[model samples]
Target: MASTTDTKNYKFNHSMIRVKDPKASIKFYEHLGMSLLKKLPFPDAKFDLYFLGYDAPQSVSHGKEIWDREGLVELTHNYGSEADPNYKVNNGNRDPDRGFGHTCISVDNLQAACQRIEDAGYKFQKKLSDGRMKQIAFVLDPDEYWVEVIGQKSVEETEGVTTTDPATYRMNHTMIRVKDAEKSLKFYQEVMGMSLYRTNENEKAGFNLYFLGYPGEKGVPQGYQADREGILELTWNYGTEKDEKFSYYDGNSKDSEGRQGFGHICISVDNIEAACKRFEESGVTWKKKLTDGRMKNIAFVLDPDGYWIEVVQNERFSGKPNF
Candidate 1:
């Protein structure tokens, strides 16, 4: 099995989005009461970045609080200019046939967010409607990128907002696009030692669910058995042909912006230093050394499909050290 590097506890962190103008995007989200959590200057890329959340609005009073109490939406302004206000933010190049879609962020009140964004005059490719199990709706970000709002939080957030316990919001799952189901199954299962969780293997829809994680010798519950942390969801479309190798900034890849399908996933651990060392030793040092501290000791690594996987060591995973 490929070494996962000694990870602390695994929890769901945040999702990253590429943008032409972070300021404009932040303004749009701020109108809806999202607070800017952190900002980073990527001098190499000649860009400024920001992370926004739904817990608080931007204000002098609320701005004094350093600790954000909710999930976040990261916005990256590329080091360039843009003539068009409506920029293309979908990652359709990775899987052209699948149509670049929007990233879905879990919310407490799906209907309320939809109403608020709708009132703010944001366009929507789809309206707020019923889901198979929950409520969902779509809205365009300031850059014309589609987004989905769901009424669910990360599995680790057992309690509602305002809770700082790291154990509450563990990284739930990640979705990826693969060319072949059988091939991915072998790579993630045989190579990664992930079990085949609930999957839609039927070729009709051409989607299968393969879960990758470290589980206890004896199975317990759905998300409880994984001692190593959370799970990685490998999504493969059995019918369509997708780019085997895609670039996040290539701009020609089908899913370049991760708007259509589920975007990149971030997993938070207790020991990021050890994880980087292990990933380095495993011949997979794609983004070694984490290079950035804006996300609080975070590092980025990509999987087989070039999808970004972030590893971090937040305070939440400091519980009983399994290592």
Candidate 2:
């Protein structure tokens, strides 16, 4: 359990996923107007990490690195995954095996964006016209990962706040399915220090969506999840908790058959050692300890639903200044 004071410097940094082709994936997000802020290539390891996000409210050429910002999508590309035709990454949205849901990119005009994407020959998992949720659409990236396209104007209209400025193309939130909503909520709220932004129930569909966000410089806004960055959306299907046979493959287990697509969500902290120590004392399940395996400083703690939360000390806490 992280004490209230322990959360002062904690920030939800990024959600990572393995990509088959970096070029295609980067182009996909680039089309959505997300700038490739940084690309860290590990030549010896034959892998790379591409951080993508928006420079909202600032000029397009604003100089903010990944750590200095929030709501980043870390696309990890392992060499040769693109070349191997036999390699197929699981989409995690299907039945039986499911966990990490999708990363949403909120746009201003849903119709225009979907048409533009269609014009580019991109595939959509769920088109705006294909589902009951007409306000949103799910288009697939090169690797088949869903990039949910929602409307910022929809939010503004719902909130009854008219804005004339261009309001679109921002990373809204990342979604992951959980078995037990209450258990996951406790882990994220009490243990993780995230505020419940909102909750919506589809009683007919038999599920509920919970939006939680760690307070950024502006703090969690008193608005819709679509209006905020670095938000984590947890989806719970009704009656899954009582079903003893129910389970979700968290995308990290080795025995799971398929490419480990959805890696983990990272949390930047002030002191990793102290944070992990508290997690240890709280009887939290450990995926990787700070002192475990061959990796040091990089730690992963498990939530109730078996999703991994990677922990790392932020650069600001390590004596480097962002500004």
Instruction: Give the winner by TM-score.
Output: 2
Report the lDDT tens digits of candidate 2 across residue range 154-245: 64353433332222466878899999999999999888878888898999989999998777666666765555677899999999999988
The local distance difference test score of model 2 is: 0.78
lDDT of 1 by residue, 25-106 (tens): 8887675556676787878767776766544332212342222121455676666635545445654333343422344444
For candidate 2, list the clashing residue pairs, or say none.
none
TM-score for predicted model 1 compared with the true structure: 0.60
Q: Rate the local accuracy (lDDT) of all candidates.
A: 0.50, 0.78
Deviation from native of the Cα of residue 203 in model 1, angstroms:
5.3
- Positional deviation of 229 in candidate 2, in angstroms? 0.7
Kindly give the stretch of ten consecutive residues in candidate 1 with the minimal lDDT sum.
163-172
The alpha-carbon RMSD values of the candidates against the true structure, listed in the order shown, are 8.7, 3.9
Error of 2 at 194 (Å): 0.9
Work out candidate 1's RMSD over C-alphas.
8.7
